[model samples]
Target: MEREKIISDVRSKAGGCFQKGEFYCSEAVIHTLNEFLSWPFDRSIVRLAAGFPVGIGRSGCVCGAISGGVMALGMVYGRDPGNAMDSRMFPVAAELHDHIKKLYKSTCCRVITKDLVFNSPERKAHCVKITGEVAAWVADKLLNDEALKDKIQPVVV
Candidate 1:
């Protein structure tokens, strides 16, 4: 498939998952990538992101969507145990972080979500949309970035 289409699909799929309550924002981002990337991670690996929603248990230190997006990038570009962190990974993650920061003007969940209460319908809808946008942002960066794409392992399954 074309990379653009794949990225678009990632956005749609992530959004769908979040809106459906199939997963939390963080899980939705990483899980969608994992599914599209052929589960490069063990399915259970998604558990690592569960605590990240609502900004590390609602303290709101960082946007869980961005954190999860970066985690998705790590699964793709992170180094193995035998080596130092891959040179390409941090830059890609930074690009994603910068993109989100530039768009929303902040990376704190509380800042981004300040207008809406967690239990409100508006908050749920907005968060679902952010989940999709973040997934697309990261996936688009990775798929089009030859430096990172070339370094990724071929999908295992």
Candidate 2:
């Protein structure tokens, strides 16, 4: 598949998941990446992102979509226990952080959705858009960068 189409599919799927209320911001991002990467970790890995939605479980800190993007990057660049850390991890994560910050002007959920009422359609729409955008951005990085792309070990079988 072409990289553009793959990125588009990822964006659509992540947004669709959030729009359907099947998952929150972080969950949608992580879920879409897992599926796209052929479950490099495992379906259960999504649990790690569950509490990140609503900004660290409604504490209203970092944007959940951004948080999920970081995790998605980690899935590719993170190192195993007792193994040498991948030099690319922090730089990639920082790039994602900067990307989200550049788009929204802040990585905080409270700041991003402050104008919309909680649980309102406006807020949902905003979150859904970011979820898709973040997922697509991460997909672009993963697919385009040879080092990152090589890290994805598609499940065989």
Candidate 3:
């Protein structure tokens, strides 16, 4: 038996953006995906995820990174406003959400970070890692999911 390593800079790329204050957890996840995938979407698209940070405006609710990842998946597989919801996007969102929830053992930001203070150095580091990992996982989803690959932009490199 052999363990395989996934070679990817997306995690670090996302973490770097978060560490540099480029965006919050949710925003960083989508931004890094957009950057690496080189999608032609407008820069402002990341704004939609803005309210999700620190658990929906620090309310300590669902994880922002997961929220953002779901949005990113939508950007790729979602239906246009002109039509009803696509049958495809829901499953992708479900998979991403479930994986993220499992990884952190919960989706509530406060539950996950109850031991850390908001914006504290430790919190920043912890968030950077989590956000980056989420971004990378979403990237893998985009790159490998056969149903989505035909719909999404090709990876830049």
Candidate 4:
């Protein structure tokens, strides 16, 4: 299927944020990249959400969408320097983070949902939902039409 559709499906089905196995939802993003851009799944997603859940206004640290977007960007443009001089990931990460920040201020879980309490299962479920929605939306946007690339983004993304 199309990339955006995949993300949307993930968002709808997964219900919310990262719930251990929820990485399965991330699989959609990975599969979309592989099909459309020939990108690898594992490394791409790890890099994408590197500082995510934490950053995603969940008191965790970073936004999952920013992390996921950065991962997608890396899949599209990442290059291993064979050493430690590579800086490509950081800039792309920053760009994605900026994009997400613009969409949702603070990029903190507390900021996104004021009542979130990490210790509660229900709260965790809510956080997961938010993460899924954001990740899918961001992934959909980045996967938009480019002639060379695939068309993915819909109104939600």
Candidate 5:
């Protein structure tokens, strides 16, 4: 499916961004890309997002979108579990994270905006864009990175 179509599908869904009344554009984009580039998108993002406003954000971990995007990236480029955190996933995810941070200026939700989590529609919209930009950045990065790009291709089925 086209990237926009996938984003539209996620938007129309009951809980992603529109339904949550948030303006997380990057989140929306990342979600869309996840669906387009990976199998079973919801299963991955939802699980990563679960701890977002609930545990991760309150605890000051990586932004949910970053975590979610990395999850997708790892699903594609991740190594076996034995190495875990220090594997290639970290460098790839870290590069993506740095890129996202540079693009957005900051990764903290509160820094991005002062609104409460999942409360303000405007904040959600902002998040959607942030996530979307991150997704696009990752996609572009992957496309340009020869070793990574060589691993994925248009599905034949």
Candidate 6:
């Protein structure tokens, strides 16, 4: 129940999801976030992230982990129709973006995995690591930010 353990657990679950080949990078992130947030959105919401893996359908543009992290952020910070937008949305999303960029030097999957052969173990490991880190980063943000934390509904047993 410690804070660090909670964040690390989110990372492990996301990474394990990808490692088990049950979900791709983006789906793992959305799935983990949805679960951690107690199903605030339907599980089907993962479909929105399905197209993001392999850098937006394998064109290798933005990192799928980054894309999923943004979506995860949106789940909490996003606004509904006719409601005022949460001011924290853009900045928080940008923070995730910048965090990945700073660590990897690029948010492009192609760039990040450039040295590894496609579908090779190295590539899969790299993606799995990124997926876990991104999930952890999102978890840390959600757990630490008071405004964002307030948005989380209590989990129903």
Best candidate per lDDT, number? 6
Q: For residues 1-157, what per-residue lDDT tens digits would candidate 3 score against the true structure? A: 1111221566776677779888888998787677655654787888888899989998989888888888877777777769988776898888877887788888788988999987799998988888877877887766676754444443322
TM-score of each: 0.88, 0.92, 0.84, 0.53, 0.61, 0.93
- lDDT tens string, model 5, 39-78? 4445346444555541254554456666666666765676
Root-mean-square deviation of Cα positions for candidate 1 versus the true structure, in angstroms: 3.3
Q: Model 3 — TM-score against the truth?
A: 0.84
**Window of ten residues with lowest summed lDDT in model 5:** 148-157
| Least well predicted 10-residue stretch by lDDT in candidate 6 | 148-157
Q: Report the error of model 2 at residue 66, Å.
A: 0.7
Candidate 1 Cα deviation (angstroms), residue 134: 1.0
**Clashes within 3 Å, all models in order:** 0, 0, 0, 19, 19, 0
Per-residue C-alpha lDDT of model 1 across residues 1-157, encoded as one tens digit per residue: 6666677788888888888888888998988888766677788877999989988877987988888998998887787789888788878888888888898898899999999987798998888888999988877766666655544322211
Q: What is candidate 6's lDDT per residue for 1-157, written digit by digit as tens?
A: 6787787788888888999998999999999988888788999999999999999999999999889999998998889999998999999998898899999999999999999999999999999999999998998888887755645432211
lDDT of 2 by residue, 19-121 (tens): 9988999999998898878787788888999999999999999999999999988887788999998898899889988988898999999999999999999
Candidate 2: Cα lDDT at 143: 83
- lDDT pick, better of 1 and 4: 1
Which residue pairs of candidate 1 clash? none
The TM-score ranking, best first, is 6, 2, 1, 3, 5, 4
Residue 106 of model 2, lDDT score: 91
RMSD of each: 3.3, 3.0, 3.7, 6.0, 5.7, 2.6
Please, what is the whole-model Cα lDDT of each candidate in the order they appear?
0.81, 0.86, 0.76, 0.51, 0.53, 0.88
Model 2 RMSD vs true structure: 3.0
Clashing pairs in model 2, backbone N/Cα/C closer than 3 A: none
Which segments of candidate 6 are over 4 A away from where they belong? 147-157
